[model samples]
Target chain A: MSGPAVVFDKVSLELGGTRILDNVSFRIESGALHCIVGANGGGKTSLIRSLLGQMPHSGQIRLEGESLGPVGYVPQVLDFDRNVPMTVRDVMALLTQRKPAFLGSSREHRAGVDAALKRMGVLEKELRPFGGLSGGERQRVLFAQALEPAPSLLILDEPCANIDEPGARIVEDVVLELNAKGVTVVWINHDWDQVRKLAHSVTGINRKVMFHGVPSEVLTWAEPKAMVS
Target chain B: MNTIYESIRLTLQGLAANGTLPQAFTYQFVINALLCTLLIGPLLGALGTMIVVKRMAFFSQAVGNAALTGVAIGILLGESYTSPYISMFSFCILFGIALKYTQYRTNLSNDSLIGVFLSISLAFGASLLLYVSAKINTHVMESVLFGSILAVDYTDMNILLVVTLIASLVVLPLYNQMLLASLNPSLAHARGIRVRLLEYVFVVLVTIVTVACLKIIGAVLVEALLLIPAAAARNISRTLGGFVAGSVIIATLSCILGVLMPMQLGLPVPTGGAIVLVAALVFVVTTVMRTTLSRFRATGV
Candidate 1:
């Protein structure tokens, strides 16, 4: 199914009497690989949170177009303890299976989960305890979970931050493959090189939209460097 | 219920007559206590896994202590001193919900909020106990603090059975969703799992179990049963299933032995203390086992 277009109109977020986002407005076309770039603590993540309805924000945020299906999210980091006995496969089952994760991975979703893992090149680590995985592997697993049941709209928070170059390639390839199938991919990134190299369109945010256009049109580094710096 | 009890009593009597069973098995209170354990042991163990996973050990403990206020309020408000099920449950549920609601509204760390609530409830319950103490046997108050398996009766068992059924039905099918919610609320919400509702369900589940088992596990030490067994299971477990299973086994054995061992040895130990001590022993043993296993792996021996 084709993905939906996203529209954010005059969205403003305030937390603890401090304005985190100010009248952020942008549109992401359907099937577009949209990159949102910004500096640390620059309201990029807050804008995503507001989009996901996790934060109470003012103004209208709407998904436009047909077949608006389930949203797939991969947060920057999973806030789990080091001692939990959850394995990589267990995490997969936790996201996909109807059975309790304690019962182990279910039969119906196992093949699909394995395929997703194999695509990310970490299928060998399926049995490894989630706490034992490397940061890169954990990030890949986060990316893998967004595939099944194959989300039409995938929201990724720094998907390539912890991964090395080859792992980043795997992510970029998979994300582009999904985009080719009309999936709307909203990626929050810090790497300007990646944004210039890959994104269909880019939005630079620092409490508001710093800049927005296709990569060719907005590749000027001065504005983004100043906004992010 | 009486007929069921009579039949079990008769069967135990027959075993005693045949010299195959201890005479304690035929006693009414012993049978009631065992039945209570059979229901509560697994429930506490299962819920304990989620409590540990969610890092809500202190929250569960606070709810357990709220049972003291529940009982004190129940007694003063003209509920039966022997079985104050209604008041005890409602008050504890209110306490649990209010605490959870306030958690989201406040900037205080969860521990601080829980500590504040715990202190107030204990102070309130203790002060009220003075007024209610004159109307009931001091033994009832002692059991409320430290628990007494021997104090359970047919009515208590029936209440426990219904509660066990309700908690199990809600928990079993939704266990995965609830875990998903606790582990990552945003993911669960994205998955359309109703994270907030599942959280409320868990709080109520903990509250009812705490209130229901007050007479057997006591207000002061009840969370120990919920935490220790799950912690022990976590020590050696390599997977979620094994963790839950190990917890349930440790808890069931602990509860049964806690009640029976005191009687078998003619010791005057309180049921809650015995149960927690047994679970604590298991926790220590598992911790040692895990350390040894890791050390051996490190040495490649």
Candidate 2:
């Protein structure tokens, strides 16, 4: 339980005949906030997918400490039809309860869902259709869902995108709180200022790991223009 | 089969004697049609919720249309015209798998892929039908296309019942996982759910349901039963439980009304068309209700 939480060694990915990532490598320390930053189409998402084991990649990704437990994920955007008649409560129930949703959620799970919703400040909208929520509200709901069945490692892909300022602050605070609880967090962010303020370590990735170090050092490190491009 | 039918007939006859239903309800064909609808309605309603939520309406429709080509191929292969289930099941399952696999492998939009499959299947069916016309009575094809509930025999009813039971068993337990996958595939995958595998499983289920329903609802109109009731329920439901239950209620009610209305009115309309029209009417009613409710809430009246 002492080594790095995750280690990626020479990871590479080829999708649809395009080389999306090449020889990317980095180490994420346990119980730390690690952020990935890059330009558009820079393979940040592909990297996250690889880490989540959603896509195939050529690499050695080792979970160094305890065996990887349930990994909570909050995707950047809600990728469902807006008109679907699913309530926030249903979403929470689906994630937390093992029983079929049609059978009605168990009382314990319902209370847990309510507590999680309350934590994310969307408790009032629990009974409302997920499609009816505003973008910010939906983001908050996503956060609430991910926090349930607490994970040892949390992966967020651009958690603040498309959210309002206050909503963004709530996300920032939540991440900080989770990190303080000794949970490892891997976040993908485009905002360098937020990365500097929040991340304990930063990895600049452009197809490969351009730099990986403390935020200040990585920021000042000279990156080859050709490699970045 | 005869025993089951006789038991149902006796029950219906008792009801008729008690002055509950029309005397015609004791007819074997009418009783079979009612039983078919009673089983298929809730099954379609439950599966249709996922179909609509996953935006797979076109995919299911394509599967339905492919049933015609399956039947035509069955007839070409010398299978019985009345019960060409072997080719029907084989062709539709393969068609659904091929479409799903192609969509997974290629970058094409689902709608475009479905359109391609739908056009090809329809063309194949038309060509094969021309060949089949000389071999069998044209009325056979007509009944397959428009659906004559009177044509549902013991075997078809048994198939429908088995499909309903099997579908409920497999789909009910995995319902939440399927919903999570449809809503956010990457998240579902991250949680160790095999998203692609679940998707294929769902497509296969839809194919099975579409094929099993072809004789009662017809290939041409089966997609309507899978779409309209769920959509109508979505308009009035605020939660998933309510949505699925409302959908089942709407589908069952529509099927019963559709089946009984033609008998009561002595209309010559096809049962499939009648059922689809009833579902459409329900959708319209629900839409109006939702709109009126919104308006009332807006004015705080």
Candidate 3:
């Protein structure tokens, strides 16, 4: 439990004959706030997808020296066909994969959903259509959904995209709070300021691990151009 | 002549006259309609929801069109209309499975495969129908093309009811799994929800429901049953459960109106067309209501 929560050993990824991640290696320890920064198409998303096992990779990824539990993913946004009806809580319940005998949320599930939504500050809109949510609110609900089953590692990719300053700050604060509570955080962001503020360790990735280690050390070695412009 | 307008009036009157009693009576047609409703309502409702969600109406259309060959083959072999549904189900399933499985194999897109199957199936069905024209009843051909409530029999109703029940039973148990897979398959797979199995299961359920509804809605218009009600429901409902309830309500009303109208008023209109027309009307009305309500809420009125 005290060891690294996730380890990527020489992982390489190719999509459409294009090398996305080449010989990337890194380790994220439990309760560690790990920030990953890169320019556009820097294999940040690719690495995250590989961790989630969405893409085929040439190397191995271990979770806590063992296989990872379902890595709870908080997407940048949940832009479902706005016409497809669903509630914030319904999407959360989808994480559990349980069926209801009748219409609507079951009582027990409702209670759990209530707590999760309240924690994420979107409890009142639980019945609202998911597509109607504002960018920040949607991100919060996704956070609630990801945390509903208490995932071991929370992987967020560009969650601050298309949001106001206040919303971005709110997400950073929540992520920081969660990291403090022993959840390993793998945040892929283009905001270097946020990374310096939240990440215990930083990884500057561009198809490979350019720099890795303590935030201060990585910052010294990572050139200004290598970070987000 | 305002046949359409007059038809609508007569249909409403028929619904009023049928009363709760007939629907409560549980005779073959009524029972069958209810059974068909129970079976088809959810299956189509769920599939329709997915269609609306995934924007897969074209794919569903392709599958429905391809079913024509199965029906034609069944009739050529001296089978009843109901029996052809099985063949339709099998053929559509095979075609859909093939289309989906070959998705990652080649550069040929999924839509291209759908288009290919759709054109071929339509041509095959048309040719078979022409070949068997002498033996086939004109009314039967019309029913197959446009749909007919009058042609629904006990056997067809039983099949529809049973299939609906079984499909619902299976899907109800895996609701979360299916929803998860639909919304985000990769995430769902990582969660240990067998994504592949659920995808095939969903296609099979849709095929069965398409076959069940063929007699009532016919091949051409059945996708409407899977799209319109769900689409209309989505315009108003904010929750998944509310969306489903809205779809069922709209579909049941459309089916009943479609059937009872022509019967009570002696209209020559087809049941499937009536259903589609009613659903379209409902869609417009729902949109208006949603806009009005949201405006009212916004204005603090």
Candidate 4:
């Protein structure tokens, strides 16, 4: 049961005649919060997409010694179709996948959803329309939705992009907390200060993996200015 | 002049004394019309919410139009309209699967693909109708072109009910996944929500509703039944659940009022057209109310 949480070997991706990620290789150990920092269009998203099996790429990604299945995904921000009205509880209900043929969602399922929302600090707002939530609150709800399944690996892309400083700090705290509980985290962020503070390991990419190790080892003040600044 | 005035007074009295029970209650024809509305009411309302939420109103219309060829085939083969469900379901499901599989492959958007299939199917249906009219009762063409709720029988009623229940069951179980997928597909996909499958399911559900309820709504205006009420509901609600619940209420009211309109007023309107007109009216009223309320709040007068 103990192995690298994620292993990406010889991953190469080409999109529209440009190499998004060329011959990338890395292995993130279990319980490590690995921050992926790169300049815009620097293969960070592509690499994550490949990991999620969204993009067509040639690579072998393994999770816990097996082929990487669908990992839990949290996006930078949520843009929903406003026509469909939905409350936070309704969205949480979606996570239970309750079928009508069954009697109903078990108490355990409801408890799990309640617990997850509480953990994200949006329990009271569960009845609120998901559309009405602020950007940070929506991110937490999305995080709760992703975490409800207790995914073995969590993949987030630009989670703090549009939020204020306090919101970003909340997200950072949540990520660190999840990592502390032994959940593997792969995060993409433009914020180096937060990344350096929270990330146990870091990978800098510009269409390829530049470095992979402790955050201090990979992200230096000079040379990789595109990433740090 | 005195006699004419007396006649006008008599008419007004009779109209007022009709007991506020819309004219559709005046005769067996009216009763049948109401029954038609009752049968298709909740089904269309529910489907409307799903359609608006999923943004598949156009897709449903395309599938509804495509069912014309199936109906033509059923009637041509000497089978009743009841027999068309087989062909219609198969055709719609095939179209749905095609839409789902080709979604990511082509540069043309989903609606464009739907349009392509829709036009092709309509063309095929028109030719089929023409060919069949040459062999059988020409009136069959009228039924397919418009709709005939007067012809609805116990079997049709049963079909509509069954379809409604099944659709509700299917949708309720996967409501969350469907909602998430509809709202933020990329996020849903990343969260392991099986976005493609849910998309396929959404399409298939809309297709089923189209074929099942086409007898009441017809091909041309089916999308209206699926959009108008939901749109009207959206004017008042801020959340997805509210929208869906509000859509059902508005749709049900529209159905009842729509049926009542033609009967009570002797409007000579097709029932399908009446329903759509009522739904449109509801949307207008709600929109006006919303605007007025917002303006009042802004002005603080």
TM-score of candidate 1 to 2 decimals? 0.95
Q: TM-score: which is higher, 1 or 2?
A: 1
Residue B109 C-alpha lDDT in model 1: 63
Residue range A1-229, candidate 2, lDDT tens digits: 2223989899999998899999988899998899988887999998888887888999887777766566788899878777766678887888777687766776877776777788888999887777778888998998888888777788999988978898888889888888888788999988888988989998888987878888877675456324454
Candidate 2: which stretches are off by over 4 Å? A1-4, A220-229, B295-301
Q: Estimate each model's TM-score.
A: 0.95, 0.93, 0.84, 0.83
For DockQ, candidate 1 versus 2, the one ahead is 2
Clashing pairs in 4: A85-B239, A85-B240, A85-B241, A86-B239, A86-B240, A94-B176, B23-B264
Interface RMSD for candidate 1 relative to the native interface: 3.9
Which regions of candidate 1 are displaced past 4 Å? B134-139, B266-268, B295-301
On a 0 to 100 scale, what is the lDDT of residue B248 in model 1?
90
Model 2 clash tally? 0
Query: What are the Cα lDDT values of the candidates?
Result: 0.83, 0.83, 0.70, 0.71
Off by over 4 Å in 4: A1-4, A14-19, A65-72, A95-129, A132-137, A147-152, A224-229, B1-36, B73-83, B295-301
How displaced is residue B47 in candidate 2, in Å?
1.4
Can you write out model 4's per-residue Cα lDDT over B123-234, one digit (the tens) per residue?
Answer: 9988888877776775654554466666665555567777777887888778767776766666666666787778787788777877776765576666777788888877
The per-residue C-alpha lDDT of model 2 at residue B184 equals 82
Better of 2 and 3 by DockQ: 2
lDDT for position B80 in model 1: 84
lDDT of 1 at A133: 81
Model 2 chain A: weakest 10-residue lDDT segment is A220-229
